[model samples]
Target: MFCYQCEQTAGGHGCTKMGVCGKQPETSDLQDLLIYLSKAISMYAWRAAELGFRKEEIDRYVVEALFTTVTNVNFDSERIVNFIKKGYNILAEARALYEKAASDQGRQPHKIEVIDSWNPPQTYEEMLAESQGIGIAARLSQLGDDVTGLQELITYGLKGMAAYADHAAILGISDPEVYKFIHEALNFLTADEGRDADALTAMALKVGEVNLRVMEMLDEANTGTYGHPEPTVVRVTPKKGKAILVSGHDLKDLAILLEQTKDKGINIYTHGEMLPCLAYPELKKYPHLAGNYGGAWQDQKKEFDEFPGAILMTTNCIQKPAETYKARIFTTGLVAWPGVTHIADKDFTPVIEAALAEEGFTEDAPEKTITIGFGRNAVMSVAPTVIDAVKAGKIRHFFLVGGCDGAKSGRNYYTEFAQKVPDDCVILTLACGKYRFNKLEFGDIGGIPRLLDIGQCNDAYSAIKIAGALAEAFDCGVNDLPLSIILSWYEQKAVCILLTLLHLGIKNMKLGPTLPAFVSPAVLNVLVENFNIAPIKTADEDLAEILG
Candidate 1:
């Protein structure tokens, strides 16, 4: 097994034996094989699209398949093997379209031997045997590290884009061109033909360009479906009732669960990235949608153990379930745990029943609160006030210290950084990283809270828009504004966002807990030269550099 698509790759290099995130070597190999076949599917679609044959559903499926392999997402080797089989089936259909398009165009299609003429074995064991021949080692050796790294870079960026796009599509929103580029990009990585490093690098940036669009689509889907987020103080304390804890980033699932569990004498509590749901008008309206329960995804084993009810993970960022509550752990929407019950078709009947059967908080927990819901609409509504404060020197700087949170020890840089921000500065945080300092009181700059919770990592579009607005108001470039972006990355979603920042030419931003192992030194040089991106240092040192 070889994987290096995440921040915590082993020893700043690829994971050769097992994932640092507890993914077994078998699961890692299966994920590698899944991507290999998914590439085949994309290759066919790319050729077919050139001849005017296209399938939006196929394009969407490619993204979903890749996203499932993201770190700490799917640990169940059986499910991954099943997903690979599904990929081969999809590739079969895609190849037929490619062949037909070629015939109609009076051209013989290029015969890609492995993908074009391959047949799946009869059993899972045979599938694994076949997968061994096409895994990352075979592919990476052919391209070499620099070229392979660039391809993986582009592929991983697309994976992140697909994850965001999938979320938007769930809300019945999508963009055709985004899907088109996803297929085109995935196809670019499949064959040795036209795989120039510079061209691949350019395509990686293009993935960033499309990712901006995907994030915009997700922002629209989220706010449109749930109503614009408004400032709300969520109780950290749990109320007495039968309880269900909902984690991950799927608001649609949360919405459905809320509706199904309403007045059924069950209380729904947001966990980790789901914490921002409390700000959405439509979701928080249900009286049973109780307060947030945990800090971040990493704490779930402990937190879920303590929580006296069923836990539902609606999207990514799920850890492997412990045996203590493994039976009560439920997954949906691309998340899978080996022994956990999965809620397919958005049905929460089992989850609701589990909550009813378990003991909830026997009485209300101690009273505590955290303010969230400072999304674009809410933050931008007070734009004039913010601008005025900036001008008057009351708000001296803005810090966007956000991204995916992880278990890495160096991740404490974000906590120290956020804690050390000046009183006159405003900290804008999103995703699970904010769990580090979100509950701490930063006080307020006039009527504005000094700390702004800008929804999920999905709400990055909102942060970008707000930054553009701030730059416009100040009559300066985004990089020239008194803003410092310190991003903490864990997975592919953060990769796409970093590329987006580089695409915008937003220079001198800091990224940590560590640079990705997949980014070869050559690629890192390009980023450093072009965008001046830097790995974060100690909080005091980095803070001094930024403030200076």
Candidate 2:
């Protein structure tokens, strides 16, 4: 199917034959149909809301449906088909309400087409054509081409927003407004009229604004529930015996694993985005939570190859598993693979059993440590001191050098940028982008480490929080602060986060290593003129630009 919703879309255009992320043509077709059904459901929900329908009942379903379409999230065709059917069922219920209302008003009831009535593809070419057709049709017949592009942009932003919202929900936090915007925006995408480019542009900005709120809600949920992250040193060294490597960005899953494995003689190490989990007070309370195992998302195949214990992926960014580590790998939550054992909603018992079955390190591994726990709360507690240091020339500059990491060679710009920063400056990083140079010893400014590892990509929430607080302390706008955001993006999550930054009027940021393939030059011009966004240059050159 023709899908270009991600950075690795085939040939930087669209994945026509098959998804480079291991999604088959059939799976792509199903995902398209799922979106179609989700749009139909959104339409019904929107109408119901206008008629004073109970919207709360359908909130969670709206979040889940949007999240299911995110890049690299769900590849299971069977699971997607089930969701499509579920959406249809919900739409049917809403239709019944509409019919009753019309009959009571003495008017003829209108009929709605069943979601299942849409033609399913019989061949690969048909699937591809259908996929493109649906996207184009949504843009033309519903949202005109430009508005369609903007709506899709906002929809993708909402997908990221829903993922974060879901994470907060797991932590027992809920924001009705976040869900409200998501539902409204999804409905707008499906609307037959009032879908002009200007209107969609306004909605796109609104999505970004609401996303900021969602991120704040999640940040509060995480820090308030788990205690703010604190600076703690984690080791990069792996032990010789049985060790289990945990990856992805879910702190709750990591916390449970740490709790269950306490005093069980099994060593736990953080991997990927989980590398920053060591900063959270509630999670770090466990004594056996070992050091980090590997670098970023791109390095997993090689790193997982020699890992001696079972590896658990709690979320996305999982590449094709190597044969050697296939049996040792496990997936949870929305992440799934064909042969991998998926830990379901009820329990992670199977994953724990597998970890236990594989005997951990035979001997105590060498003690090595890497510093973590530099999220917003931890940083804000010391904001006044940071401001004083900046003024006194002890901390000359602040660099936000983070974003998604990928296989592209140009990503080395991040490593070099981190390396070239003045000794007096501090580097703040989050997401997989930090893997480029997290291992480098940037030394300390006073007691604070020069390089701070904020949480995951979503933890951009933390970075934003810290920036705003710092701006407040300095009695100036956030853009007036010493910090500069040098970001590398490879996915839609990054797109949403960047949009949030732009929506907040944050300017003069550097984005790289390559521009998004989906951004038409016209749209790019608007971003450049309005946001002052630029691609990353050589480290020395960028350093001069920022420091000068």
* Top candidate, metric TM-score: 1
Candidate 1 backbone clash number: 0
Q: List the candidate 2 regions with Cα displacement exceeding 4 Å.
A: 50-52, 55-57, 96-132, 136-148, 192-195
TM-score of model 1 vs. true structure: 0.96
Tens digits of per-residue lDDT for model 2 on 285-396? 8878877888887789999887777888887778878998898888888877777877877366666666778766676567767777888777888877888898888998
| Superposed Cα deviation of residue 84, candidate 1 (Å) | 2.2
Residue 110 CA error for candidate 1 (Å)? 4.5
lDDT string, candidate 1, 1-548, tens digits:
78888887788788888788888888877777788777778888888888888887678778788789877678888888777777777887898888999999999997878665777664767766776777767767877788888888887888888889999999989977777677788777765643788888888888888899999999889989999999999998899888999999899999999988877998899999999999999999999888999899989999999999999999888887888899888999898878888877888899988888898889988889989999989988989999999999999999999998988789888888988999999999999999888988889989879899998899999899999999999999999999999999989989899888878889998989998887888989998998899999999999899897
TM-score for every candidate vs. truth?
0.96, 0.91
For each candidate, how many residue pairs have backbone atoms clashing (under 3 Å)? 0, 10
**Model 2 clashes, total count:** 10
